[model samples]
Target: MTMRNCTLFYSFANYGLNKKGRRTGKATLIHSLRLKEQLELKQKYLNKSHELMRTKNEINVEWDSSLSHANLLDTPCGMVPLDTFTQAQRQQLLLDVVEPPLLSTVNTSDFGKIKSRAKYKLSDWIKNDSFCDAGIAFIKEILASEDVVNVQHSIYQFNLFDMKRKSQRTEQLVSYINAHNTLIDKPKTLNFTNFQEVLFKIPIVNGIGTDIVSGKEMMQTMKEFIVHFYPDYPIKLMLLHDDERLAHENTGAHVHAFISGQNALTGKYDLRIAQIKKVNEFLFKRDGMSATLFSETGRLNYEQAGDVAKHMQEMFYEFVNEHLFHPKNINAAFHPESVRKSEKRKQMRKEAKLAKRDRPFNYHTRLLEDVDSLEIKAKKLDDKISQREKVVDDLESKAAYLSENCETLIIKRDALEQQCIKQEAAFQQNQRRHSKKIRLEQEVDERLSTKRKEEKKLDESILLKQQKHTELDSAIAEKQSILDRLSVMATQALYPIQKMLEHMNNRLILKGRAGAAEFMQHIIKAFSADLPTELRKTLIKITNNTGDTELENALTRKDSQINDSFDM
Candidate 1:
């Protein structure tokens, strides 16, 4: 597919030591006016459009202009002319338009400080001398330093291009850098110490066939291109769809991409724009997309920055008034209707004032009979006055009696109040005693409950121990039974060997010398056959003469005993 044609505009602004970056004191004024204009425009649109008026309560068109600045003029008032505004408004305007404030030193007090302190409008502290000096030094340092030759060395070494691709979401990229005025979604205060801003204009054009490229698509394509080419840099992107003057008067969008010239890893301001442009151009050609690239680099002074800010604000409001609140759009149709309504109301008020001014006055002329009537009325009034004097005297006596009764009633009320106070004190004392008694009873109940829980636990422990003792006793009895069985088995196993020994002794006594000799020979033969040859030879040497002599003598004694027993 043939890609969309685009343009890239690159520019940079240094924040230096100023926390406000390119934003000036005038930015405050422009910002306030922008908010007020937006509110007024939206209100005007709602008034004329019937559809909008139906859901007017649901619409959120309010702009908050409240400021911490003490001066009322510092706060935003919608669309009021400078000449018609109050004194406070005039002071606020001057504060923003004035030059950068001077620095306070030991030798000299800054003129701006004196004015601001007296008025309590020291909100422009960001434009002080220290900021200006640091900014100038930073610029000089950048210029004096040598151009970075091997800017791509680290990019290749770290293999940033091979890293996992980041999300195309613009918010993630914007979180890393301050975008300043390019971001129109919300008011962002520029507070970076040292930074650079770059702009890219990309016009959506028709591709092959009837496929038309949209502004958003163009913006996204440009974003991906930049991010892919400069993957290692801290870059941010913002798309401005309202900028219509691009690619030879064709209505198109522009992109603002801010890249920190500072190294992403080291945070050192060593990166140069040459490497960026080279990669951007190569990528554009490689992708077979028509693109143009341009760059501008510099630091803006206070007056210049203020002028630029004011100009930008003027453009912004013009765009908002013309395009955002266009007459053809239903949302913006209420403005004219509201204006007409206001004029009609004003005309009605004017006509009512004119009608009152033109009305005729009545003339009064008195006759003779009228004078006679007045004299008769005066006499009647005097008679009534005399009767009223009598009534007043009676009223004075009645008031005196009522005053005396009121004092007596007040004395009675005081006595009742004293009795009430005594009753209240007695009731409070009884309540306290009852509460104390209840508390002591609760404590006693808690102690009894705790004792019962402890007794239960001890009883359970003793039961468990007794169960274990019974198990141990049963195991000991079982072991004693097993030992008795083993003793019986051992006695039965030894009976046969004892009987064989007794038989051998009886043979030696009954058979005399021959039996003893035959036993000795059998013993020798058993040792030779069953024993190892070496052990058998050792036994023969040990028992050769001594064993035979002992056996024969023992046999002879046994034979003689038998003979003696027979002769007896």
Candidate 2:
């Protein structure tokens, strides 16, 4: 729009604040504050000649210092980092930007007291308990930390609204129109040039726009997401302008709808800074829950504010939860910010456990297992060796016994040879003794035969002598008897004995030896000697003892034999 159009847009906003009872028909307003809008206003109102300077100033602010540190690998929401401009940075990009009042904060308990009012009847009140909770949560989340806020910027690039991509911006406007789809009511009159112009001015947050988001509608959509999805944060909308090039193309004329962190109970950045101002002063005062909360955008009346806060809070938390508020980003969502801490303690404990595991043992586990196996095998081998040793001992005993038996056999053989030698010597001695006895017996038999022959011859000679001697003795004794008869009769016996002697001598000489006389006496003695020793001795002794007659006879025979030998 031209300069005159921008001034005219602001003029309608002042009129609504002054007239209490005047009913103003809905018209777009450029009221709410954006830090970017201030920079635009600074260029237009304050510096007319430094056009290049303003552009440079705006560009310098828009160029994010954060981009220098950002790694391309860094994804803001989830996948791709959207080029999210800040409120200050966003407003700085537009040509004719504006600033609005800061939001209000409310204490939660005050609303319970107002419930007694009939218009504020609890039954007619929307079921926004969960929605309020979601708003509270959204507020808490943005104010959680600086890093969390950075993530929130990336969220604006989602399907809902994206100023960077013209396609997304176009899509957002189309979707918004479809959601509240109004049959464009034929105007009572269409002023061909100014039909889209205001009949009655409607006060709005910042840029001129329709209530694209309805009050009842915002509450209904918000109740489900805000109450069910996120229930702690309160929602607020700020405004921004279009790029001058794209401005006229937009029909609804709203710049940007966004959220705030300051609670409505207090005029401070309650979630961020602390202030005593009550949230009600800035809020749209009316019935239903809307009368209870703040409205940075004039589009929401009492009901609309309630609904917008609820719906926006829902969308805010959804975006925050889905993008900015990842669970890994916080230690405890339920706790106050006071409870978070550094992780050094946990790291130290883990390191201690690892050190303990690295301590050495008495031996390696694998070596122990191998040693056990070796011991078992050695025992088995020892058993086999012991059995073999026993067998060797048994064989040695048998061999010892055999050696003793062999020695005994050798001794027996030697004894047998000695016994054979003794038997042969005894046989030779017995044979010699037997042969000597036989020779002695033969000599005795020869001597006995010779003695017997000699005795027979002597006996024959003696008989002859006795016969002859008897004849001779008888003759002699007869002659002598004739003579002796005169003297004695005994003389005749002596004469026969001499004659027998002479005959015996002759016979003895022929048969015996030549010396008969001496032989006769000797023969008698020899005969006697030839007889048995005992008988011969006894006869000689008897002859000697009786010497008278026997001696005379023997003397006579001797003389006769001597004479006969001479005569022969």
Candidate 3:
């Protein structure tokens, strides 16, 4: 559809149907014009404020790696004062300031007098004229430079170096070294000024179970020891390279406490070891409770230690890891105030960048686009309001013409009402029939649901019977197998008895034949000798009867008669 038709149709459906189309369109057009004016005013205000807002941004300067010297701008630029240069130019100049030399000796001409007054060794003191003629000239150049002094504070702050605190610590350390120096017997002594050149090592005592302790736990324990035992001394405890406990690994979670006063003397502090043992005995009297310390000689010779300077450097790194290492950022607890402030500024800048990224569009960008779009929509709405007003006028004219035919229309409305009444009655009848059909369908559904439940129950019963039948069949099969085995066993048991009975029967028959024949022969011969002719004939008959079956029967009968005669 055309835009005009779509707008008109929406107007007719929403407003024309309620007979308020013209009024609503006029009100809408007025509101749109007001909105356009407000947006234009807002746009003007934003533009004025934007013009007034002046932001100064700094360009970050990065130092060049060439450490040789600053590339000073020649002639015109170099002649200007350092303050006249932009911040970027100044930062570049600052990079030219090289690190100061490690060994800057001060005058120690009265070392002997000072040592006598303090009653301490002055062996480690920097002797006068330690720095040759060239060193003095270099020192003079640094002291004379006006730019160096002017930027000295800024340079220190940038490097996060607290020079005041550093100086104080150095003095204290020097005194400590001199005091302990008198106690050492070594010919070659440690220089307190460069005590950082000394090597230090802490042992993991097998008895103390240090090998099994966590790095953090061991560090904390060492801190506690220093706090309790040497409350006056400042000690920095750290944990490094935790892998020493394993046979293959040469590192473990061992605590290394860098005691600042340990280098006060050149020789190993045997006295400190004794003190440590005393602390352990005081705190824990148990046998395996003491911590041990290894000699610096062993650690100094090890491959990892390499040299005293490198070992000290590693110790510094370990200190940094313990004190400054945070998961996402550096911990500034030990940092100087100036460095902490710089860190805060960097964090704020990061957060601002994140906020800018999250915004959908800047307010200024939205304002410019909204001003143009509002004016266009307002103009369109005005034109729509005029067209709708014309349509409303046309509708009003049609309504006036229809007003003249009102009576005639009212008569036809009554007739239509009567027809509507009849239709309503027919609809009610149909509704009642539908209700009855719905009721019948509901009854049928209920019956079907009940039948389904019965069918499910019957199926379950059938399954149960089948299961029982299977079990019974299994039981019967098992019993049948047992009976068959028993029958076989009974037959096996009866076979031996049957064989013995058969053997006895055969033996009895043989014995009966042999014995009967022998007895009949003996009786017949003896009787024939003792008897007369008639008696001998009878005996012969008996003897003849004993032959085979007939003789056996006659002899048996005669022996029975003889046995009967003996009883009489």
Candidate 4:
């Protein structure tokens, strides 16, 4: 069997305890004691397991010197440089030195009043709580005296929003110390600004076979792992039982830890938690424990999964234009003044103009320009022809006059008559040539007129086609926009449905029910029936076409196995 990798789950909660005791501070004391007992029991079991392995010669019995009892005794549970004490000693210090002052500062009546008003005024509760004030004062006193204090075992819950307020109070308390150190020209050691609080959860998987280590030991190992990864930053880890998860199941409760110190290297706390989970999967496997909280299919039903997939696709479509070749975001990213004068931008505009010149519309424009040029040439030819005709008429009148004086000057008249005949003949030839040229020009004009008419018809047809194309494009864009909006609405509607289904699935699984498959089928059918006619058809179509036979078969097989187990 392949080992499945585990994913980490984490969530944040509001800081203080509520009036109804949902998140009571006293629960911390109970959790500490319970954890101690559980750890001792686990240690005993592990020793027995080791002995059994040794007797069977299944494992080596070599002992590491670093984990020896003497070394463990010297290891302090809190600040290592300030104190030399074991885990037990640290717990004792908290119980004896811390609890006395904490309990005395907050009497029963005052505690009652704080709890009653906590729901309405959480900030006031945090500020007025005598227990918290006492703890803060006690720490300040120790710090002022430059004495080592180990109070790691005492749990102090503060709302994340109140960190700034708490920091201010801490600074006020430490002002004396800061002044005294400054007077002596010493470096500041207690700066609250350098630290931050991080909260994360680790779920415990039950019925995964016997646990090899206790929760405390697991926490210690995880802390060491983090320290190994981030050696420069100093960190402190405190484990607390998840109140909500524990309410559901007292045994094998989920773990919540508070990490206080410098921020993670990536600056994202969730990313740091994810890294820990990824590495811890193999670590947990090696230690004979399962880290997974749910099955491979997860808690989501098929419909819920489909809804999530659809939601993701809608989100992708919505943002796709911003990232993919669209210039909107690009234009927004740059300064408008700079972009307007940019050489590359100018080149792009020029290229666009050149592209427009190559269109069919531009070709029609060139044809119109050719027709105008032809008209100009024809007008110049007509003017030259008119001047030639006037010259011919003047020569004819001169010839008539010469004939009238024929008897007075006989020889000269004969010569003039011959000249007149020759000129008349040449004029006739020139007239025929001009007439032919005029006829040819008329024909050319007719052809040009026909071409102009054809171009006009073509332009009209092109315009009509373009109008239709534009309408189609607009219709498609409008439909797409509507579809996107509907998809978003559907996703929003399905979110709560998914959550409810997930919750149901988890409950069914926990109860070891064989009817989970039936329940899911009923839910899908009911949901489909509730949809509008068109939406129902679409849903049915998608379901019929996009069926995953493998997943279905696996679910069926699992259901059958569950039934068989119940039967047995």
Candidate 5:
């Protein structure tokens, strides 16, 4: 055997087989332990790598609360709820939340109080429990510690009235209005037009052309503004309601205040328009409010004052109507300066004048003059009634015209309804078609996806089969090599036996004895004679030992001898 073959046989006998050529357990145990150790090392490495990586959600925010707290309130940043606000309002809210104005240290108690006889007070009022105190605190931290009230020629914009928090502000406003109309420390002189200004240390804010800021939110901001900037100034905040500009949904409502801080400090009206502009700018920057400041020149104008006074009166009247005060009280409160007195006042006057003599001698002469004037006034009243009747007839004709117009409107509304129905039907049809198209598309996509998956699996299986085929080819090649080596070994092992037989045959032939080869061939010929005739002839031809020269020459031919040696 070759050296490689000998070594391979020895290894198989020692490791894989026992003396009887049975497989041993020692090699199997060693392989199992090696595989287990490698698996353990791989698992350990995976665990170590897992600890080194982290996901995106692992990190946390620091100031997320302050930035997003506004979203939770009914009114965020003094505006309406985020969902209800317009794009402009939302933008303004974001600006306010991002960078709030500096808040002054104005206390809630310092807000203007009502001068009315009402027993209720603002400080003790409830319902506004969760006010904008947090927002106020935030603002206070940002503002510089400057005396805004006493600053020379500096006009401060005030947000004075918020209708949202109506606990005591409305009452206080009524009292303020009452004070303006009716003089204090004197008998009631309720001249609303003459009574122009009432001073109070308060700020007012109300929404105009928007419903973003509720009365409560406005109040919150107003209280904070007064506390911070207008604490030292006279809080003369007024509520002005423009009935003409009033919106059905509470828009176009604004608060007005006389610039009294500068008046208190200098005792002279500041004429600088720059101060008003600066105040407006500051208010816009701080709270996103466009605070319109009235200069002294504008304030003194009759038309402006009249308009403001009218709105103020309307605000007071609106409150009175809502609260349902007695007519006597209303007359006393609103028309106290009128010459006509109530029954009680007349009685008190009569009781006080009991000590004085009564003078009534001119009564008869006055009665005659009063009767003549009554007749003339009655004739004028008759003419006025005729004119009013004519106006009523005109109104009746207009009503008839409106009634006809209503019929046309109803027809138009029916046409619109029919059009809407048709549009709705078309929309539904389109929706169904779209849905069907989507479903078809989805089915097609699913089929394509399934096909792709099948193709991928087929490709993977083909690759695996190719790999296995290549490995089988290699194994077959290796087996073929082993088989070739084994064939060579077998040939080498049988060569000695063939040579020994040849030597033995040569010896026998030289001694003139029947050699084993010749004797075997004669025995084969004798056995063939007892077989079938055909078989006997074939065996005789092959085993014949004839001494003819031609046959001997054929057997001794070079090609024949070479073929015989190779076959052996």
Candidate 6:
């Protein structure tokens, strides 16, 4: 695959897929160009406005951290001046600018992967920041330079001779022939001169469940077999890779090359190399970028290892012939050095981008300060609201009390109105009774006056009648004296009686007013109004004088006649 430059895509901004299955590159490009110009214009206007957005920051200065100190070239989080952004531009700073990086290193790896991840903690740990100028200068110089060499380690071993017992001569001979042909590849002659001797261990170790082939038993068998069968010679050891985790338990196996130990079945042997079967199987295998191949048991293996070498001679041959060598020019691309170099350049570019991100404006710090101030003001407002509510409640209670008092006054007014009405009715009845009593008293006084006038007239008339009677008596006495002397002259006495009556009448003329009938008429008028019967009888008796029979008779007759009228 070839790497394509993506700078042209940014020119269109987003060359979206169209309905015709082509990129709408030209249309979008014109639109994006116009939008960019508009954004730039808006940003210019924004810068003029903010001039000074912050009214105060001194009270909230302690809330800021060490990063708040801004370099002119560094972006100091959200504490930047408001002039840096417009309404739309501000949204971009939060959603796009503050986001994490796209090519950042992952923290975990899959199985069999062999790359160093860019973990910050690991980098901190390995940061060799000593004041050692010599070591530091050397490392810096190496990093600045281009060419370098890499190194690795391996080992080999072989066998010396063959042996057989009398009873199993055929099986031992055949075993010796097969082992010599496979491991000890040499001249095809059946004689001992054609065989060669070296050392190697039988079992491969590490990442296996158990060790079935004992190195000690094999080493002892090989050593004794060599001394008895071939005698008086030495063998060297070989290794495929250097691994310290293996148990070089025996003194002779301490070096990763040769492992000399006793064999259980064979009495003795000399293992000249730690080149186990796992170390030799890489002869015809293919390996990948992470160095993947098969182990001794034919499962896959990876990273920092190759095939085993059991003998010095065989170990040397396998290295030269098993892998393709002798270089010829094919292509300059896809080389391991080239790939690694490009990865380094990518990391350098990312570091430069981060430097650009640390610009001179940030908005988070300003936002935090404003929020703190708002919270303080809100608390003060809450206290004022509580005080006003209490005052309103007191006013409502007073209004309720006043309303109740008004109702009580209305009841008292109604009662007073009822009392006034009853008194007026009583006064009207008393006035009517008093008017009737006055009329009755006036009638009684008129009756008393009339009775007194009638009595005065009746008493004068009675006195005149009494004087006339007295004169008539005196004249009669004078005539009687003369008649005695004239007894002798009798006839002449009758004639003198007439003359005496005339003289008595003339002498009996009395004083006082006349008209008794007029007096009686006035009495009747005065006493016509009803009076007590006892008072009426007393008036008659006073006017007639003491016990006058004529008057008493008249009174008795009047009483008797009035009683008779009652019966009728």
Name the best candidate (by lDDT).
4
TM-score of each: 0.20, 0.15, 0.16, 0.19, 0.14, 0.13
Ranked by lDDT from best down, the candidates are 4, 1, 3, 5, 2, 6
**What Cα-based lDDT does every candidate model obtain?**
0.34, 0.30, 0.33, 0.35, 0.31, 0.29
Candidate 1 lDDT score at position 46: 27
User: What global local distance difference test value does model 3 have?
Assistant: 0.33
Cα RMSD to the true fold for all candidates: 50.1, 71.4, 50.8, 35.8, 53.0, 63.4
Residue range 431-502, candidate 5, lDDT tens digits: 323553365456545645654565555554564455445545554445435434433333332232223223
Error of 3 at 112 (Å): 3.5
426-472: candidate 1 lDDT, tens digit per residue: 32433323553365456545644654565555554664555445545
lDDT of 3 by residue, 231-266 (tens): 543442122223223222222233333333332333
- Model 3, 525: alpha-carbon shift in Å? 99
For candidate 5, the 10 contiguous residues with the lowest summed lDDT are 4-13
Deviation (Å) of 92 in candidate 1? 24
Q: In candidate 3, which residue ranges exceed 4 Å CA deviation?
A: 1-110, 113-212, 243-251, 262-568
Error of 4 at 303 (Å): 29
TM-score of 1: 0.20
